[model samples]
Target chain A: MIAELFAGVSTRARVLLVLLAVVMLAAPLVLDRYLVSVLILVCLAAYTGQAWNILLGFAGLLSLGHALYLGLAAYISAGLYVHFGIGPWLGVFPAVAVCVAVAALLGWLAFRFRIEGVYFALLTIAFAEVARIGFDHIGFTGGAGGFFLPVRSEDQGQWWNLRSGPTFFYYLALLLAAGAFLLCAVLRRSRLGHRWLAVREDPEAAQALGIHINRARMSALLLSAGMTGIAGVFQAFYANNLFPSQIFDISRSIDLILAPIIGGVGTLFGPILGAFVLAPLGEVLISITGAIGLNAPGTKALVFGLFLMAIIAGVPTGLWPRLASLLRLRSVGR
Target chain B: MTLSLYLEVLLQGILTGLVYGLMALGLSVIFGVVRVVNFAHGEFAVLAMYAAFVLFTALHVDPILAAIPVAALFFVIGWLLQRFVVQPFIVRPQHDQFILLVGLAIVLVNALLMIFGPDSRHTNLSYSYDSWFIGPIIVDKVRAYAAAAAVVVSAALFAFFRFTLLGTAIRACADNLTGAAVVGLDVKKLYALTFGLGLACAGAAGAIMVALTDVTPMLAPSFTLLAFTIVIVGGLGSMAGALLGGLLIGVVEALASILVEPSMKSMVSFALLVGVLAFRPQGLVGKPA
Candidate 1:
């Protein structure tokens, strides 16, 4: 499917893609442990960004509470692993299923009531806030004290337990990101994708044309939530700690969408490019701040905010589209 | 809870809620006139709170007395923001505008974080520890002062919109944008003015609120959400509704904290918001779209 999708790509672009793949595959081998960890974050962000792009970029549904799904998946999967002795690989299925169900319920409530635009966004935030508060009060998941996943020295090389070294996690994250990218490419060309575009561009017109607006939006939400849940599982094992206040924060949700928004929403490669640009840039800024003897805690966030504004004001289409156009590459999956 | 306790909590809620109403009134005004939801509404309020805090800590100025200068300063800030940051995007899609304001919100919040650090700060007014007893109920002196100041500011705002020519012009713009333009109203300038007025309300509310609670950069987003809940419950674009919604939310939160748990107060507020959204999206007093 990926080959078929890439068949029409220009020779230059194909070469670029292959080169990029080789570089990513070879990254952990040469880079330091810290840089490899950063790459893993970039890949994880790319995966989540692609997941979010499906709803916001493709279907025009602005959800400001996507962290709800991520946090839920993290808690559920980690809880299962911690208590039931189930591995993340097995626990992931239930996590994704729960997320999808939640998305279905949320989507039904929203579409049934004809909540659109900012109201819909606010509804998402409200749901996330409710979940955050609920989670904070629930002692089973450690509440505000935070949930932890026990780490054993003997599980160093266990891929099944997802307790391997940073290199293993990096590869795992890369696979997830690459898989998500290909999935998005294929989905963007599918009938549902076309419907999403149609609905996003003009919902009234799409409805007139016999499109199932609610169904399309619901499917997008389900898919996005499910995909994001997988990332959550990865995060559970990677971070080894989950706090309701931090995981379910609105700021976390904002972080998920920033890559897609900055990379060029609705584009297949935008999330990947955006993740690559943002994660490293953020690391660089953090290091710079540390080196300058600055004790400020929010300088990174401040820079990100300024960057978001600059992107919105100057390149509303985002960086990927402009860069692609500059290289004279044919618009892919448009 | 006992009846007197409930009444006391209700009175306290009403007092705090009045300030909340004033805060949301700014949001309602901007949304009504400029047709833009100030996503940074809470950040502006937090900035005002910081302003008042700085004044009080530095010059020993009372927060109540500091409200005026803070409001005036925020008015100019809001006006400039509308002109420079928001004006260009007025014709863009709603999503773009939302992102723009979200970005602005992020900037303002982190700026506060950088300036004030993460610790929560509050005014140490001399009368902060004092309380007033009226019959069977007790009122904190700070709460009474803040609530009284809120009432005064809200009344002045209402009078401005009612009696002043510029206020009428702004109202006319909100009523009919094209018509106001056709009638020789400088729509752009009016929008900036309305934004300024809205932020002024937020500033005053923030300044007054410093005496009631602590201020921190992290409080900004919650404040924004709280203001949003109030405005929505009261009905978007409705001035009176903002105040009404604030009072309702404040009372509900107080009741929940007392009846249930303090942590569950937000849960109840969100539940209320969801109920209102599900049943009455137009809000209690707002006209149906």
Candidate 2:
């Protein structure tokens, strides 16, 4: 069934997949552990951004509060492990469920009140901030002290268990990143994706055309939240810690969005390409500047902002669309 | 704490809210006229604090005296930013200007961070620490002075908009860009001047901030959030809303601190924001939505 589905995918997507496979296979050998860690971070960010792209980019429902799901998932998984002896794999589903529920609640409230555009964005942010503060105050989540996953055994690999070495996690992250890209690619070409784009272009027109905007948006929200939850699970296992201040922080959400947004929002490979290139470069910038005796404050964020601005100013169509045009490759729709 | 202590905190919060309102007034002015949210508005205040610190340390100048030149310098910077950076994208996609301003904010903050390390700088002005006693209540003199300065600046700004030709032009530009352009109101100049005015308000706010709290690059980010919350609560582009909203937040924050953990004071303002948004999005004293 999957093979037949793969067969239907275009040549461009196939080429991109092969390229990603090549990079995945070659990364650990070519890159240093630090660089690989940065790559891992990028993958994590890209995955989150891709997840966000489903709701915000594709569905035209902007959510500035996606970090809430990410953080909540991380905390849930980490908290489960810390208290009960349940490993991350078994705990992942619950995390996703919790995040989806929360996302649904937000979507319900937003749709009920008909909060659209900037107001919706602000409300999402407010909700996330509320969750952040709530989590910060709650003692079960370690309040402000943060929750940590114990590192067990430094051997070859523990695939069944989550706490593996960076090399092990790197491959794991690569697999997940590939999964995120595939999820987006699959979603973008589906019937739902068409409805989403229609609604995004014109909500009233989409409604007139028999597309239910709320239903489409809510579905997008759930999928987006679920994907972000999965990424959070990956992040918790990979990092071996979850801090409310760090994970649920507004800055983290912003960081996650910057890559996909600057790379090319709503595109399938944008997050992958964006995270793969930008994440490592940003880490390098920070480390290099630190080495050169210049105190850089949020250099990554600054760079991301500038990159976003430059993209908006110069390449409004985004890198992938421009790349597709240059390479004479054609997508099915456009 | 005790009831009296609680009451005292509430009183202090009301005073602090007044200052917040003043800061929001600056943000409101620019947002009102230009319809562009200056993400770097808080940085103007930060820069002012830094400038004040420099003057106080180097030349032994009073902080207030230093603020005048600081505000003037910032006015020019703000005007230039609007003219060069912001004007090009005013008619483009809405998100473009937002992204540009966000980028500019990052650049400004990072540049400031590079110039001045992350350490908080205190402008140890001699009379800044003095306090006035009102019966049983005590008010920090610097805070009172800062609050008073905010009131004066806000009043003057209100008057400027109400009485001056340029002010009316700026208001006109704010109301309808195309219409103002049609009326030959120098829309571009008005936008730049409005931006300058916003920064000038921030500059004054910064001088007051130095007198009350220590100056640091990180300080502006929190103030940005506070100011944004105030602006939203006060009404998106209402000067009066900004004033009332700031004071409201300051009081809520102070009271929340007394009731709960001091660190959670900000959380209180955030809570109020959410509540207001859910029930009354336009704010308490705002015009029709």
Candidate 3:
């Protein structure tokens, strides 16, 4: 089944896949520890971007509230770890369930009232803010102070799943990114994907074609929320901390959308490509400028601003779709 | 809190809301005429506040008196911005351009942040410290002036939209841009003028804000979010809706803070946005179809 699935992928995608796999396998051996951390960041960002794209790009649902999922998941896992002495691996279920429940409530409100377009975007943002405020007041989630995960037993040699090294985190992130990519790929070929695309193009037309537009949109939203929730869990485990102010921030939501949007909204590789180009560029700019005794402030926001402008001015079609066409990866539509 | 203290807080809230409403009017005007969100609208208001600050420090001019020239200058800048940056994308996919405009806002914010560090500054008009005692309410002089200014300016805008030839042309564009174009209206000129008018409102609001409250570069985000909530509550394209919506939001936010906590005031507005969006998407005073 896996080989057949692989066989159906385009030649360029397959080649790129092979190249990525090779790189992932060889990165720890070849790259410096610092570079490995950077790559791990790229993976995490790519994962978040991809998860975000599943809703905004494919379903035509612009959710500026995704930080709620990230923040909630982080809090859930971190709280469990701090309070119960539960391991991160075992705490994934409750975190995911809570995120899904929150997303479902939001989705219910949104879909029931038919809050389409920019209104939907604003609604999502409002919900996220509410979550932030709620978390701030709620003592269980550490309130305004935030909660941090206790570090596991410090043993570089132990591989009993609580791995702590940069290499271990990098590998874990790589695996997660790979899973996200594969899931997106599978979803693109699924019935739901076609339905989502149809609704995305024109809801009335899709409804005329007997597709349940709302159902499709809601499903996409839930899946996207769940994926981002997992990313939050991963983030908490990696960073071992969760702050309400930082987690449920509007700026964080903007960051999630920026990468996928700058690369390509709907394309599978857009998030990864965007993360690869933008994340390290931001880090390098900050480090280089800091080294010269002048720290570049707002470096990430500035670069994203410029990137968004360039995409608007120079390439109206996102970088990934345009590049994909040039490389003959696939046609514009499935 | 005492009942009198509660009344005092509510009155203050109403005054604060009037200022908020004034700020939102500029955003509504621009959004009504141009379909663009004007992500840089709050930054322009902040810049105007800075301009007022300069007027206070340099020429020792009153912020209110300085508002006229600031409004005129910003009108021209806003007009030019529409003519150049916004007009081209009037017919195109505005998502990327909207992001670009947000970029412009960030640049403006950081530039101001760099020039004027994060220190908060407010113009201290000597008489502004005085208060008026009416029945059980003690309204501060500066806040009262801000509310009074909001009423006068909003009423003037209302009259302009309702009566003037140029205002009618702008309203025509707001009602239907393509239809106005088809009717041989100078759609481009009207758009620029509308944008200018919007920025003028922002300038006026900023002048009032400086007189009444502190100013800072960090004020952009809070002001932006507050304006968004007002716009959502007021209805996107309706001038009358903005005025009514502003007062309503202001009162609700004040009462919420009294009943709840101080931090919940923002939550109140956000909750209003969400509730209005879910229940009455057309907004409180939106024109009936």
Candidate 4:
């Protein structure tokens, strides 16, 4: 079946995928620790990008404050670690459950109340801001003071604990990225995915065609929240701290959305390509400004802003899809 | 606490609410005419505050006295933004417009930060700390002045929209864009004017805020959220609704600060936003569709 799947794909696509996979696999080996750390960030961005893609691209839900999930999961996992000594892996289970439960509840409330479009997006933001303020006041999470995960190890090889070094996280994020991509591919071909696209195009028309719009949107939110919970777990372990202000920030959500949007809103490869390009571009801008000895404090943010505006203004459809058309290759997304 | 203390806080809440009302009204008007949320709404406030700050230090003028010029400047800025960056995306999916505003917000906020370093600054005069004691209440003079200014501005705005031809045309566009266009209204120019008027309101609010609170480049995001919450509480595009919503939010926030941690006081507005959105999307003054 895997061979059969490949047989139908064009030679150019197959070759491109092979080349991309090889680069992803080999990147950590050749790069230094600092560069490998950046690669890890790219992978993390890709994983979250795919998770976000399922909601915005597939289901037409434009959640402006997606960092709610990431922050919630991080606090849950990190709080459990800081106070109870529970490992992050163990903490992820409850974190995922919390995210799914909250997502389902929100979806039910929204759909039942007939809240859609910009109203729905505003509700999501309200929820995130509420969570941010709530977390900041809670004593167990240390309030605004912050909760720090213990990094007791001096040596660099604690794989199970997830505190070996940047290298361990580098591979972990790569695996998560690969898993997320494959999962997105599988879901894209599934019945739910098809229903999602139908709903995205026209909710009323899809509803008339016997598709359940509520269930479709609900599942997408749940799945996206679940995947984001996993990334949050990784982030808690990787960063070794959880500050509600930093984690649950509106800007953090913006960063998550930028990947799929800048690369391609509705394409599979768009997010991956966007993640690959945007992270490095941010770093390059920072380095270049530093090398030039400019005292510009917001160089990265300024650049990111310009890049997002340029993408929206220049190619609202996304780069990969446009590039595919230009190259006469098979389109990469559903 | 005594009833007198309660009265004092209540008076303070009403005053603060009036300024918040100004912020909310700006957002309400912009949405009413332009049909898109300006994510950079709060940045306009920050801009006005900075403008006030500069005039006070450079020309030895009262920040309140300088507010008019700032509002005018912001009006022009808003007009240009509508003409270029925002106007193109207005016809696309509303989601695209939201995205456009998000990018615009990032650019505005970061650019401001680059221009004005991240430190918080404040203006102090001999009268800054002085307050009026009316019966049981103690009102800071600057805050009182800001609230009084808010009332005057809201009145002026009410008249502008209710009596002016452009205001009626704006209302027509908000009510039905196609119909307004059919009626020969210049919807495009009206949109620019409406956007300018909205930013001008924010500028007025920002200048008032400079007298009462410290100025910071980061002030806009929170104010934007505050304005959004007030707008949600009041109802979309309803000027009267913005006034009532802003006052209500202000009172609730003040009461929350007294009852809970001041740091947690912001949650009151957000919680109200969610509650209002879930149960009453039409808002306090909004008629049910």
Candidate 5:
């Protein structure tokens, strides 16, 4: 299946992909632990960005509250593990299920009311804010005080429990990123993907052409939410702590969308390339700020803001398309 | 609980909501004229609050007095932002514009955080504890002043749009952009002026809010959300609706905090926003799109 997916790729692109895969597979062995962890973050961001790209880039449903799914999934999986002794391997199922259900409800409310464009985005934000405040008050998920996962020293290498070190997480994240990439590639070429493109380009036109606009949008939301839920499970186990304020903040939602946007929205490699550029750049910015004795907590975000503006103003299509064109490579999964 | 307590809360909500309406007024004006949402509307307000705080701390200037300079300063900043940053992307996709404004918000917020630290700051006014008693009701002096100032500013804004030629031109552009352009109206200058006026309102609102609440970089996002909620509930682009929505939200939140809990205030407002969006997408006073 993987080989078939890659069959349409040109020779140069195929070679680049093969080399990239090999390097990623062997990265943990050569890179320092800190760098490996950064790679894990890149992978996690890529996974989430890809998920977000489906809804926004493909289906033209701009959601400013994607953290709703990510936070809910994290809390659900963490709660299951903390209370019921359910491993993340099992917890992920329920997490994704709940997120999909939420996406269904949100999509229904939005589409039913004919709330299009910016209003739809605002509605998403409202839902996320409601969830954040509701979680802050709810005692079950530790409320504003935060939720924590116990790190059993004995379960050091337990993959099922997600109680492993950086290497394990790095590999898991890489696998997820790669899987999402393939999934996105396949979906982009599928009938549903075409329907999404049609709806995104012109909703009324698509509807007139006999496409189920609501169903297409709903599918995008559900698929995106479900994928993002897995990333949330990864976040819970990797961080071992959850705070409603941090996880469910609009910033988190913004963070998820940035990579896809900066890399090139609606492209297969955009999220991955964006994550690769952004996560490490963020780490480097932190180090530079530390070295320069600028102990300001807002420096990274400030730079990110400037960077986003530059990208939008300079190359609105994002870096991926620019880089691809500069490199003279035929765009894949367009 | 008691009727008098409810009345007090109602009054408080109305007073606070008036200021909230003022904060949202800029957003409504900008959207009405330029067809662009200033996502950094709250950050601009926060910046004004910091300016007012600085004026108070450094020169011992009263925030009420400092509001004029702050509003004037913010008007220039808004005009510059619209000309240099926002103007280029005015014709871009809505998503692109959203990203551009969101980026500006992040930059403004983080810059404030770096400069001021994360600590909450407030003016140490002599009349901070002053209040007025009317029969069985107690009105906080600061809130009354802030509300009065808001009313004055809003009245001025209304009069400008109603009576001034430039305001009429801006309204004409809002009414028909192509028609305004065909008639030789410098649409771009008018847009920048509209944006400037909008941020000026935010600046004034922020200056007044310093007396009621602590100023912090963290408050930016919530303020933005609150402005959005107000505009949506009041009906986007409707000046009267913005004020009314602000009062309605302020009252609801005040009553919610007293009746339920303080943290649930945002939840109630969001619920109101969602309810309004679901039932009346055009808002209470806004004409149907």
Candidate 6:
């Protein structure tokens, strides 16, 4: 199946793919630290957005609370690290376990009772809020004051447990994102992928065809949560800080979902393209405005809001698909 | 704890719940007709609160009295928002509409943040902290007034819906837009009006909240969430259901605070929301989906 899939790739697509790989591989070495950091952010956003895509884009579950998984991973790992002298390297294990467990629990409750559509979205939001509020009040996790890891500037040269310079973080994010993209790509070709698409398109019809709707939703949710948990671990160490409000915020959830929604839903490359387009642009907008001493309170948010509004109003189907059709590219998506 | 303490908490919770009903009324009415969740509901409320604050500090009007202008102003704003922004994409997919609303919410919030900065502003009315003592149960004057005003408004709105021709037209649109249009009722106009009416509810609630809490752009999501909880629990398209749900949520919140830490209050409120969705997705009063 993998060979056939690759064999189906057009020559032009392969050339572009090769060129893309070369650029990505050499980017860290050639680019400035700031650009490298931005690239890392773009990759991280792509990874997180891909995770969300499995649910909302592929399996048709619009979870507005995906930050719950991120929060779970960050808070659990951060809490364990701070309280027990463990590193996030070791912390990812427990975080993944708990994150998957919570995802399963939420998925079961939502899917088992067939609470779906916008209600499912609402349920996810409620759960995410529950996690945020719970974490904010726990004094052992530093409550609302914030929990920080002791990463000194001189720790840049180290690489044993993800302690390194900005370049190292960039590579790690790139690898993680590439791995996630591959996993999702493989999953999209597997039998499970076909079932997921069926369920997403029409649940009743899928059920009539003997697809277990609950199981399908659960697996997508669990897969999505596991991926999100990994991203959380990466972020926990990368940012070296874990504030409950920062991690579990609704806006944080929005940031993750926005990439896929804006790029294109149900497509493999949409999230990556979206991350590349949005994350750097957003950070750049903020920095550019700040450098000018504009001191505007929500310049970044204003840009994002306008961008999102324009996208929704103009290209509700999202950019990737529209661009794909306009460029006459092989429809490279599920 | 003691009987009197429980009574006080219960009464306070009920009053606060009524205010929640008022806040969610606009959301409920909008959902009933438009079938889109107005994510900007909370921001609209916050803006109304700011307007009320301006009225109190700049014009010497009472906060309660400021509710009238706030409501009026929000009605127009809501109408324009629905017509220009929301109407364009109302025919799109539900997810797309959600995105639109969420984007609008971001725009509204950041716009406020840019204009007002991050500081929360509140009116310092002469009776801000004044309370009425009634035999071991002390009631906040602001709370009582807010509750009374909310009840009167809700009651009047309820009667209007029940008897008025325009009100019935709106309900008909909610119940069956295509049929309403077939019957020659202006469905689009009714939609704008319903959305306006809903925003008016949010504005009135905002004015009442000026005496209860500070106005901040950051408070938007919580207000939206609170309204969601009330509207969902009450069931969409049911105003009385919203009031009952709001009261129930208020009592639960109060009890949770008394039983646990105040910080744990949201933990209880959201848990209750999850429980309700799990058990009754259509809500206590909503027709089954």
Which candidate should be chosen as best, given DockQ against the real structure?
Answer: 5
- Tens digits of per-residue lDDT, candidate 5, A162-247, equal 99989999999999999999999999888999999999999999999999999999999999999999999999999999999999
Q: Where does model 3 exceed 4 Å of error?
A: A1-12, A152-163, A292-295, A325-334
The superposed Cα distance between candidate 4 and the true structure at residue B105, in angstroms, equals: 0.9
User: DockQ for each of the predicted structures, in order?
Assistant: 0.75, 0.43, 0.50, 0.66, 0.80, 0.71
Candidate order, lDDT descending = 5, 1, 4, 6, 3, 2
Clashing pairs in 2: B17-B247, B21-B246
TM-score of each: 0.98, 0.92, 0.94, 0.97, 0.98, 0.96
User: How big an interface RMSD has model 6?
Assistant: 1.3
Question: Chain A TM-score for each candidate, in the given order?
Answer: 0.97, 0.92, 0.93, 0.95, 0.97, 0.95
* TM-score of candidate 5 on Cα atoms, chains taken together: 0.98
lDDT of 4 by residue, B1-289 (tens): 4777777777788889999899889999999788898877887788888889888888877877676888889889989989888888887888888887888788878887878778988888669989988876788887788899989988998998899887788889998999999989988899999899999999988888788888887777788888989998999889999999999998988888887767777798888887887788889899996
lDDT per residue (tens digit) for residues B1-289 in model 6: 3988989998889988888889888888888888888877888888888888889999888888888888998889888988888887778878888888888888888888888888988678888789988999989888899889888878878888899999999989887888999999987788888888899999998898888888888899889988998888888778878888888888888888898988788788888788887788778998887
Residues B29-52 of candidate 3: C-alpha lDDT, one tens digit per residue:
988887788777788889999999
Worst 10 residues of 5 chain B by lDDT: B60-69
lDDT by residue for model 1 (B187-219), tens: 999999999999999999999999999999999
Off by over 4 Å in 4: A1-8, A154-156, A293-297, A332-334
> Regarding DockQ, does 2 or 3 come out ahead?
3
Q: lDDT for every model?
A: 0.92, 0.77, 0.81, 0.85, 0.92, 0.85
Estimate the Cα RMSD of every predicted model relative to the unseen true structure: 1.3, 2.8, 2.4, 1.7, 1.2, 1.9
Per-residue alpha-carbon lDDT of candidate 3 for residues A121-190, written as tens digits (9 for 90 to 100): 7678788888887888888867888876666576444444344788888888888888898888888778
Best by lDDT: 5
Off by over 4 Å in 1: A332-334
Indicate the worst ten consecutive residues by lDDT in candidate 2 chain B. Answer: B93-102
